[model samples]
Target: MAGVAGNQPLYICRNCKNPIALRSDLLSKAFIGKYGPAYMFSHAMNIIAGQKEDRKLITGAYSVADIYCCNCGEILGWKYLRAYEMQQKSKEGKFIIETAKIAKEY
Candidate 1:
């Protein structure tokens, strides 16, 4: 069955831990034929979490914190993928330590 984004539940950003409203324009354009299952499954069941550098440890420190909604300031999920460390880990370590696709909205 095709999932409708309009009728689907949207969670806030997991990073900031704030509420985020669905981006209507992006959502509408994302789905196919009004409301597509693939698009809804991808968005509704997906959470984009990003990590940032902490400039206070004297050394580079990254927190597994930060989840922001594209539409609004809300946290959806937390991840360890920092833009600086995105490609700094080995294959096994990357898989074991890093989280590519984190958890979903509850």
Candidate 2:
């Protein structure tokens, strides 16, 4: 883990200094339909999301919020929730951070 100014490892937008998430709370990977692979985060800070658009995908079904960086308005990723009831739903609601849009901030 990398350390920031106060010993916290953070995930920040690559295009700006906007903090997106804490390293400790980030999940390794997530799958979002046509968007493909993304890093999963339980919580992301300093982000803005457009209106949630509900859609069904081959992987599963979800209502996703197109999330972006609050500082620079860069597309970060999506916050999704299972729009329909599932027999076995794991990650019901969570933020998916696109790996390419972020960098480890230390």
Candidate 3:
């Protein structure tokens, strides 16, 4: 894990409190996941991406990989592997982490 300055807030795994992503990397909070509300982030750390698979979501069809917390192995959300539609291509390489799986740290 990378060293985060004390002043910077970050998101941590709810299960194990493992540093997952920085608050500054958050892009949007208006996303929905398999469980419920989720957040979109430009980057994520301390995570493992599972196998890529095609899924039909509300937005469109996408190739995504389930993301897991490296420490506890809990399912956090998913990473956008590929976007089938050109319009959604920007989401490629982004991460969608369910709110229920993480907590904000100050």
Provide the TM-score for each candidate, comma-separated.
Answer: 0.24, 0.81, 0.95
Q: If candidate 1 were superposed on the true structure by all CA atoms, what would the RMSD be?
A: 13.3
Listed per candidate, the RMSD to the true structure in angstroms reads: 13.3, 3.0, 1.6
Which candidate ranks first by TM-score, i.e. highest?
3
- Model 2 poorest ten-residue lDDT run: 28-37
The 10-residue segment of model 3 with minimum total lDDT is 1-10
Give the runs in model 3 whose Cα sits over 4 Å from its true position.
none
Query: Per model, how many backbone clashes are there?
Result: 12, 0, 0
Question: Candidates' lDDT values, in order?
Answer: 0.31, 0.76, 0.95
Off by over 4 Å in 2: 1-5, 30-36, 85-88
The superposed Cα distance between candidate 3 and the true structure at residue 99, in angstroms, equals 0.4
Residue 86 displacement (Å), model 1: 16
